[model samples]
Target: MRINQPQLIDSTLREGEQTPSVAFTDQDKHKIIQGLCRIGVDEIELGIASPLNTYLPNLVKEAKKITAGSCRLSLWCRCKAEDIAFAATCFPDLLALSIPVSDPHIQERLGKDRDWISKTLTASLQQAWAAGIPAVSVGMEDASRADTDFLVATAKIAQQHGATRIRLADTVGICSPARMTRLVQTMKEAVSLPVAVHCHNDFGMATANSIAALEAGADSLDATVLGLGERAGNCRLEEVIGYLALVLGEQRYHPEFLPELCQLVAESAGRDIAENHPLVGSAIFTCESGLHQHGLTVNPDMYEPYAPERVGGTRRLRFGEKTGARAIQLQLHKAGLRLDEMQIKDLVHRIRSGGQVLNQEQLLRFAAKCC
Candidate 1:
């Protein structure tokens, strides 16, 4: 219920859209920004000014017009002068400069040695500072694969040069929670700079890794609404926010709106809400097992975590052929009919024998048949 550890939340509009097929229109992006600010995010990563920058300008222009001015807006970019040049046009509150710290990337992809990358990063940081921006953060493009000593040294250099925060980005999405915690601890011990996490979900551990990082000393996490990003995606905003509330019980922030945000991003990304998706999935709160249904009738807490009402999802009784007496009776009552235990039992037997999946119409028919 109480947490001494402080963590910053950067929301979905920016990093989330990196999902293979997700894109947010200006209106959609603005809506997310408004909600994220209301939800008390410490910072917002408004992913514009990419190599082919367009979203950043649109979001910044629109964001400047909106009134959710509580959180800082940060734009993500590669470690390039032109990207920084693009960022200066809007002069956002926080500018995040991303760089490749791994030797392989520095040698092959970046085509520059560590010395060059470090020098260029320092120059870029100074340029951002001179632009009169409030803060500049550094994001290591692939810290998971980067040499640990090299990563720490680079982070220290960035902090000395002017970066207030250093983000350990899981660029290839390859960090487990344990690795995340260890890396975060290493970074925390290495520099006075605030450490942040930008995890991708290629290995499906973005949220877990992010939580681990925060516990170990990360002050901020980069999350996209509904886990939308390039590979598997960054951590899902709703997932972590819910954990921070329900599991950690900080209660300072309400997490009920997470489902709404998930729907928005899912629509933007052209993905259906997977049935097993946490918290917001249609099946998360629905109970259908015969024995589980019997227990639920007495007290839903037997299996459910927080009540469905807590997250804006409804408690639902899914119809399954393996219906118990209490479950069958409950369904009969829900159907506005009263039936004896025998009638309900017989009905359950009939439904189970046919291997027939019941639809709404069929359920109604079964209810009426009991009449």
Candidate 2:
């Protein structure tokens, strides 16, 4: 299952910060950057270079010092001179200039035509290059919605203007995996530079689309911790890296750090992680169903796709109304307790009648009192 190691461009700060009411302080930024570096991500987009805030420069400096060149830092900007100029002052390893490619976004948002977009993008890239930025990544906003020919042409123009990479942004997350694969493949065939993908989660397919892009020939992928972004969110950092490891057999990232990183990002964003969040969720590794518990007891792999430890998690069997006698026995044995058949049967009956899930402490107390 070995495959090419696609570079991970974690956009937690740039995109995740865009989540409603989410803001990261200097300390929060540093912690996130440090964790991303420790996990060996290829790059991190710090934030947009506009607004010229007093804290942004200091944040970029602190991030640089923290990373110490272990991971690359990139800055996002609009297709405007001022944005690029200000981003250049941050001294990021790469500057990502965004341009609207779709007709709707172009005509509605910018009130410009396709020709205008191309010219503006060309000028922006030239400006960024003239500023002597280390590198430039062109962000094709609404790329998935744009016409394929126009998208490819835009990428070509960007390359002509010295863009080091072309980021295909699924701005609305309306792309399916099949569409993603086709678009990425077409872009790869048309462009010479690396093609990266930034997917949103409006359709709950950002992760699938990103992986599809990778399989189609993309060089890098963008993600945010917990998929925190505008609307539904973006591709989840933990989910993408974990999928690469457990399914695709790529192991460059340190999955063990995801739990801590997830907590850090969630705390910074002031958001609660759902119990069903794929990688760092509290209930992802918790088993409750009788069939699942039985399979897990026999062999974890029989029921679980991968071990919980693979993503810095632990497995726990929940005793609930669905608890079978064998599952209760397994739980009791795991808790280092022994019970006769009658006691076990009685306990199963009580659990089934309780009509709710019981935690380890409650189960332990029950077992001790009954058996």
Candidate of highest TM-score: 2
* Best lDDT among the predictions, by candidate number: 2
Q: List the global CA lDDT of all models.
A: 0.78, 0.88
For candidate 1, write residues 319-344 as lDDT tens digits.
65666567667656766778777777
Q: Candidate 2 residues 1-371, lDDT tens each?
A: 24487999999998999899998988898899999997879999999898665566777788889999888888889987877788877788898888889999999987889999988988887788888898999999999899888998999998887889999999999999999999889988998999999999999999999998998889999999999999999999999888887777776778888889999999888889999888889889997888899889889989888889988888987888987889878878988898989999999998889887887778889889886
Over 4 Å off, model 2:
330-344, 355-371
Which pairs of residues have clashing backbones in candidate 1? 14-47, 18-229, 19-229, 48-56
Deviation in angstroms for 79 in model 1?
Answer: 2.5
Model 1, CA-based lDDT: 0.78
